[model samples]
Target: MRHYYIYLLKPEIASNYFGKEWLIYQLFVEGETAKKDLRTIAQKQINYISGTIPTLQIKKNLDKALRIRNDFYVLKEHYYIDIKALESKAVLKDHGNMLTISASGSYQAETVFFEVLRQINPAFFAMDFENRNYGWLNPVKQVNYI
Candidate 1:
């Protein structure tokens, strides 16, 4: 089976465009064959999923995320999985991986949920006392990269 890497938009960046509930983005094949480069593969996947962005306002938000000029910001993390594994998990659909738990109902959800436990807020939150440990107290912005 072919090996692949699925890159997901960071939750913070995605929240700006999609909102809090959205998590996984799509599947991107790891290697190059023929003339298709990795960047080309990424762009193709992005264009395919672009359909999910309906409103001009949301599109503008997505564009803002892209403008950061960091591939790390745009597509922050990746998962390495084999084709057979993905197929068995039922996440492989129409050449893309359906990333959400409701969409896939598979192991991907477990992976994401586990990561959320470690995530800290990007900015300070004055409303909650828990903020003392996560947001401002933590000098480094915590994001899900696992």
Candidate 2:
């Protein structure tokens, strides 16, 4: 079994025109080093998925950490697609802005997941095989013969 993870990056800083708080939604997909630079893969994912991008309102003196909560809402909504597909057959770990999903099956599922993530944001992505524990912790579990 192989696992694929996705992390959404929220805007860390905002401009004065936006009142020092701007929310940018980015998607990070795990695995498949070769297709990461491809743009068509992302477009295909969007054509298949259903959802709207979330909106945020920033208030004065709001703590930067608070923005994470808002980002979770967006993540939660996006995560549902995978949840519906895998159901209890997979394990899911939510670490604020990051989500780790694991399932038992061929690598095709991972490819599809990556496509979806790319569809969300082609600019935000990182791949790691060794340093998986450094950032946010979100894990999903699955079982299958690989």
- CA lDDT of every candidate: 0.29, 0.32
In model 2, what lDDT does residue 115 have? 45
Task: Give the best candidate by lDDT.
Answer: 2
The residue ranges of model 1 lying beyond 4 angstroms of the native Cα positions read 1-12, 19-24, 27-35, 38-116, 119-146
lDDT of 1 by residue, 1-146 (tens): 11222223333443443322222222222222324676687666554443331223322433443344322122232222122444322111122322221123344432332233123222211111122111211123345677
List RMSD in Å for every model shown. Answer: 18.2, 17.7
Can you write out model 2's per-residue Cα lDDT over 1-146, one digit (the tens) per residue? 44544344332211111221111112122123326545356534422231222222111111232333321122433331233343322333344434455545444434444444444442222233333422221211223468
TM-scores of the models, in the order given: 0.19, 0.30
Model 2 residue 25 CA deviation in Å = 21
Residue 87, candidate 1: C-alpha displacement in angstroms? 24
